[model samples]
Target: MKSITVRQLADQFQLEVLVGEEQLQREVTKARAHRPGLEFVGYFEFFPTEHVQILGKKEINYLHALTDLERNLHIGNIVKYHPPCFIVTSDQSGLKYLKRYCEEEGIPLLRTKLRTTPFIGALDAYLLKVLAPEISIHGVCLNVSGIGVLLRGKSGIGKSETAHTLIRRGHRLVADDVVVLKKLSEQTLLGTHNEVTKEFLALRSVGLVNVVRLYGRKAFQDETRIVLDIELTKWRENELNNELELEPKFVKYMDVSIPHIEIQLQPGRDVAGLIEAAANNWYLKQQGYSAAEEFMKRLEF
Candidate 1:
């Protein structure tokens, strides 16, 4: 149910407000734009009234060719539907009547200098990003070896400490505590830091520290595409070991599957080194080099 106001769109694109100053707060619920070409010719059955109406060169020319009475009737029919707003592309000069009608009817009208194709593309891109499905996860996300690694575990499992060590080793932290995950597409999930805890990492005894200020801007990144998920587990007695040479596992978030790995924590273990090795191994796998598979082939020979 998220919506963007006509005023917000105008400000974002720096579009000229042709009329309907009082209707600036009108909300557009749909991301797609509709061309009123058919609607102008008395075909209003399947018209998209919730989307932003776009008037381009052909539609304007058609309007100009119509007789005055016909044009008025067509425009009046469209106005009665109460579309979210109207955008006239290319800044066409013969839109005086359209502008006057919109002003009198209090329908927000905007003008942009860009052609129809480019304007629609840009607007659609922005709206898709703003309205994309999003979810927040409790984990620490970092860019390790150019791969986004998400660390998840219980509260006292040292996830923050491990991330801090990784930052010291020249890795960048994307988020801590709560990571806002946005489904960019069917197979892509983007992770970003929560606004309240951005750039700040909390440690048990050391208290809160700003990673950006302490380790420079390179130690923190705004967001990253999450490609790997790692869960830290406490070492327990008589626990079964998972076969590392088997096919990779996956974790689903927002209906997208990401490669998943689990690491057990024990005393006297170099967790940071292990994480770095995991990232490098992931990179190698991406490049089609699997050490386990190679070793199995050698054993078979």
Candidate 2:
């Protein structure tokens, strides 16, 4: 979990502050931005204070159409609840008076030149990324054949090296070493790297190497949704029975169950190739084709 402040949002969008500059440090904790649609209709029973309010053209016009008493009473009622902030879109004028009530309540009042739809679209996306629930895992996340694959195993078990190989084969690396995983939605887990480790991978013999510098920009992706988890393990004679996998194991990240596979490594085994195959196979499963299930059906096993 990360904390995002009103100041950060204001700075990110380059919004102009109309008042309550001192309260800009207030946190913007919710991903859903509210429009006060219910509040204006005299419904305050479920006013969501968690959301950052947006006053678009419709709301602005509605306000001006009302009598002075009605408008003041409505604005006062809403402002008293104290939302994270109020963002007026379209550079709409004549609404700065809303700033008066906002200032009285110590709520930050802001404005953006972007129209309502695009600003809200970008704002929702920004909030989704920043306020998403996050966890840190040790692995290399990559975009392989449009599927997000996470490589996890023991330390120095060649995860980074396998990822390097994948990058060379035209796949894109999302993160190496410390993979930051964020739950963008109930089922989507997005993997990324922090500033310190982004675009860099460490190998046993070679030191830290920037994949983008060597492989160029096409070999790197800032973030990718993790659809598969692949763990590499030293090949063991006892586990040979499971080598011909008929089913994929399941792993959970933030309560989302994702398909999991394990690859046993040997001296000459193509680890990268197997991982790539797993990604493609998972993608195929998504499109209603499962090799393991088909094989089992043919064998009647």
Strongest candidate by TM-score: 2
* Cα lDDT, all candidates: 0.88, 0.89
List residue ranges in candidate 1 displaced over 4 A: 35-47, 56-79, 237-244, 280-289
Residue 291 C-alpha lDDT in model 2: 71
What TM-score does each of the candidates earn?
0.82, 0.94
Error of 1 at 94 (Å): 2.8
| Highest-lDDT candidate | 2
Query: In candidate 2, which residue pairs get closer than 3 Å at backbone N, Cα or C atoms, i.e. clash?
Result: none
TM-score of 1: 0.82
Model 1: weakest 10-residue lDDT segment is 237-246
